[model samples]
Every structure is written in structure tokens, then in C-alpha cells.
Target: MTLHTAIVKTEENKISSEEAKKFILSEQNGAESIFVGRVRNENSGKEVTAVTYDVHDQAVIKSFQSICSDAKSKFDKNASIFLEHAKGYVSVGEISILIAVSSAHRDEAFKICRYILEEIKHKSPIWKKEHYIEGNEQWLPGYSLRPKEEIK
Candidate 1:
């Protein structure tokens, strides 16, 4: 298989880069690129203690599949990709997302990895609420799932 994708619920498990690496490893691959996203300690002057990710699981999986396919078609047909995103409570320094790609060249691997990440951020039905050290939380603005022309 050229692509593997998932949405991991943090309460039960966490996103693993090692797993991703293993999934995308190949003897034909000359280059490998991996991206890891983590819940940060701060955002916009607020001290972030944790983050809650709410996702529509089915839709997110569909989007992930589509994005990975598109990335492969656009960059390299033989690219192997592994993508996973965390759902539910993720503490600071904890992984939120992981994308790994292996391909025949450095450029193709990097491009595929980047394309998957950008597409998911724009197309996935995932929302985030940031928990702060001050005992408050706020929902961060994210890209709309609707087309720009549809929003009037």
C-alpha cells in the first residue's frame, strides 16, 4: 500500500512517529521526510496547558485518504505516505499530528509530506480548543470546510 492514515484518540493511545517511519519504509525509497506537530506551551500570549481536538472521525479519514492520494498524484506516483492525527485531550509537548513520506527523491518526499499537512488543515473536519494555564479555554479559528464562494 502506498498510503496509510488514521485519527488516534489520545485517551487510549498517542500518535507515533516510529510507527509512521516503519509504515513508509521501503528499499526503493531514496529519501524520507517526516513532520511532527505537537501541542505547544503557548499561543497568542496565553500559556497553553493542553488542547482538546474534536473531529468527525469518518469525514476526517475520508479527507486524509483523499489528501494522500492527491499528494502522490501531484508529486510522485510511487510515494509511500503515513499520516496520523490525534483526537481528544493532548497535553503540551504531546504529538498532535504525524506525516511521513518516502519516495525516490528528496523533493518528491518533502512535497508529498507538505501537501498532506496543508490539505488536512484546510479540508479535515477537526476543531481545537486550547486549555490555558489561567484556567480558561478558547476555541481557535480554523479553516472552514465550505468553499470560499459558498460563504457569502
Candidate 2:
């Protein structure tokens, strides 16, 4: 079953990595994998100021849910999946997103977890704006939805 797929919007909040860890353990599968993203102190030779995240309210979340549902069909009905992505100002070493998946075997769990992470980065309407040390902010180039790339 697809469960705990979420996109958040706020100033800043701590993501409970331990909660995710516990959930993964409780699922009790033969294999498990986790992906953890962190905010860094430096980027492109610039001192990192902070990152601002903005995501399409409904569409991004629906996309997340769909990823889980489809993975379940291929892997196993008991395939456990979870994702938590952050929004707003994030500092270095803070968790940006946590993805954990478990399956009956090692290979299937690894593939599903990796697939979900990349699919989220590519397909979700989540955008990030970089705050540079020079007191300038810029949205990631080529990330803004172009007219031609509308999800029609």
C-alpha cells in the first residue's frame, strides 16, 4: 500500500530521521535501503547562505504517491516505501529528504529505492532557490516549468 508520501511547506523544520529508521526496521523485510539528502555549506565555490524550497501543492504529492503505488505492483504487495522531503531554509548537515524501502530480497529493494529518488528529482514539481553568500538568490537554471514542458 502507498503510505506516507508528503510534500511540505514551511519556514524550517527538523525531519525525524529516527522515525523513518524505526519505520523501516518495523517493516521486517529481508532487505532494506535508505537514501538521505543533506544541505551543504558550500556550492559551486560560493559560501552557502541557505536554500528555499517550493513545491506545487497537490501535483507534487500526487506524483510521489504514484511512484510508490507503481513500485509496489512490480516488486511486491508488501514492499514498504516512505518519503519525506523538506521545504524552506535548510542548513548544512540537515536532512533534506529521507527514502527507505524494504523488500523480500536485496536487489529488488535497492532498485525500487533508487528509482523513487531519481523519479522524484526529475518528475516532481519541486523547485529550489539558492541563496548565495553575496546576498543574491537564484532559482536553479532550467528548473522552472517552461511553457512547452507543461504537464498536459
Q: Which candidate leads the pack in lDDT?
A: 1
| Candidate 1 off by > 4 Å | none
User: What C-alpha lDDT, on a 0 to 100 scale, does residue 113 get in candidate 2?
Assistant: 88
User: Against the unseen true structure, what C-alpha lDDT does each candidate score?
Assistant: 0.92, 0.76
Task: Put down candidate 2 lDDT per residue, 98-130, tens digits, no spaces.
Answer: 888878888888988888887887778887788
List model 1 lDDT by residue over 1-152, tens digit each: 87899999999998988899899999999999999999999899889999999999999999999888888889998999999999999999999999999999999998888888888888999999999998999999987767789899
Candidate 1 clash pair list: none
For model 2 the TM-score comes to: 0.84
Residue 132 lDDT, candidate 1, scale 0-100:
96
